[model samples]
Target: MEEKKMGLMKCLFVLFAGGVIFLLLLAIYPFWLLFAKVTNLIGVKGIRNTSGKLQTPVVFYEHSVTKRIVAFVAVIHIAEPAYYAAIQELIDSLKGYKILFEATGKLSPQEEQALTQKEKDISSQFDFIFDLMKKINELMSLQYQKDGLTYSASWINTDMRLYDLIRAFAQQDISLIKKGRDIDDPFTEEFGQTVARWFINKLFSRFIPVGVVLSVVAFFSRDKRVAKRLILDARNEIAFQGINEYLKDSDIVTIWGAAHLSGIEKCLKKSGFREVRREWFTAYTVRDYSLFDAIKKGMRATKEAASAATALKKD
Candidate 1:
């Protein structure tokens, strides 16, 4: 009888586990779609899904009358790193243009190559996407600095405290990884790992306090996977929110991760925008570090808009 009872309990446990997984899938599926829509509105494009008909990019060309509305979406990656200008080029080709402009941040071939390596090398895990970003930034800065140009940080914004914490956290994480420590390694008393973590979190907490808190939570919490997923979801929210806010007044042209951009076209129409456009802008081929020069040249256009006060002031 005890054996039979034990078997029944095992069955119940399995069923409960299956039910929980089902509920999670049900919640994440719709949310994934909702996120796609918002990301599409600003300029994420080229989405395909196995489950449903994906959204397409919107392009509006209005003239003289305000009746015309257009939202442009462009999905970008290492292959198509130059899509950041796709929408702007379209708008400029026309005469007497007035429209709202918004864009997701650019991901260059150099950055993409770093991300791919980080992803492929399970031995070297990364925290946030920006963790990889800082490495590529350093690499790019080196080339430029050697060429007699000084570069600050790409993560810089209005808040100095928050910016420092983010930079420090990124610095610590990247350095640790380069030293060959797996992400899952337990902290040792001799290593003073907690001090490093604390320095990063406390210093940068002002810029991204949520990120710092979550990092600390991940450090202490056992459910690190769930914490990571929550952080990613938060990043998606930030991208979507930033894109939405930018679209409110300008003709938006955005380039963000292709995975994130998928299925966002539908959201633009629902938001009262009309006629969106999307296309393949560029393709990225995987190469080595020596190819950094070509990749940097491809991404040099970022400097033009990167210096725009009007765009920077929006965020």
Candidate 2:
């Protein structure tokens, strides 16, 4: 009876350990898949180094029949100043190439001032998100794209208007403004807005990494289809249209967010463009002090301390 009990307990312990390992792998699989997809889209083979530094890529595609070149300059919104400088230098080198850049509903000062109250309110909500992004940039010791890159008057904007985006989201029954609101709450829209603002303020105050926060927000969003359709598909279609209409047989240079590149690449491939060259740029290096690094540092400190003690004894 004792032998049988021992065997049963061992079996149960093995099963429990296996279950825990399976659960851990299951939890990690989605993140690994996402990372793989992102790297594939941006033409990055291995994004991270041993030290946890990440690199992004810029891909160049050429039309098969026309032989015209199109350079897709993938960019992060916030990165080291040197990254933007390298991008600017690349743009300067392509002197005659027409630049197609990404900016949605950018308004002139006069146009901004003339917006109606509702429009102003909607704009302010978007501005709040941008402000949070800027705060994150500052927290990460990174430079904002707007400050880092010089914009040219000649570059074309291949993005939709803010009102158009709102309409698209509304069609999908997704309210961008009320996105964070509690559905069970019995309150006015103003109350919801206030609560949302307070929540965002608290969230940003914690100084969480922007990428992690964005991934969490995306994962928790109620309508993922809406985001895919409006943010990625529709925007990509507009960019494709701009390329077709404006970039007729000219060596085109596009500056867009790295996330948007996959969709744009699909469109380009369908239009006879194939990726010819790829270059990786180091965006930022996060210093991850691993166990080995910590041990090395501790040993150096101990050696220094011992040397100091020996000198004190000699004195």
- Give all candidate RMSDs, comma-separated: 20.0, 13.0
Which runs in model 1 stand beyond 4 Å of their true positions?
1-73, 80-233, 243-248, 263-269, 285-315
Best of the candidates, lDDT:
2
lDDT of 2 at 201: 35
| Candidate 2 residue 1 C-alpha distance from true site, Å | 48
Q: What lDDT tens digits, residue by residue, belong to model 1 across residues 205-234?
A: 122223334556667644454434333343
Clashing pairs in 2: none
Q: How many steric overlaps does candidate 2 have?
A: 0
lDDT of 2 by residue, 1-315 (tens): 999999999999999999999999999878866764454344322232222345666889999998888888888788789989988888899877888988776666776776666556556666766766665565456798777889988888888876666545655655445433333242223333334334433332222233444657777677764666788789989988988876685888888877778789999999999999987776665543344444455557667777888999999
TM-score of every candidate relative to the true structure? 0.31, 0.62
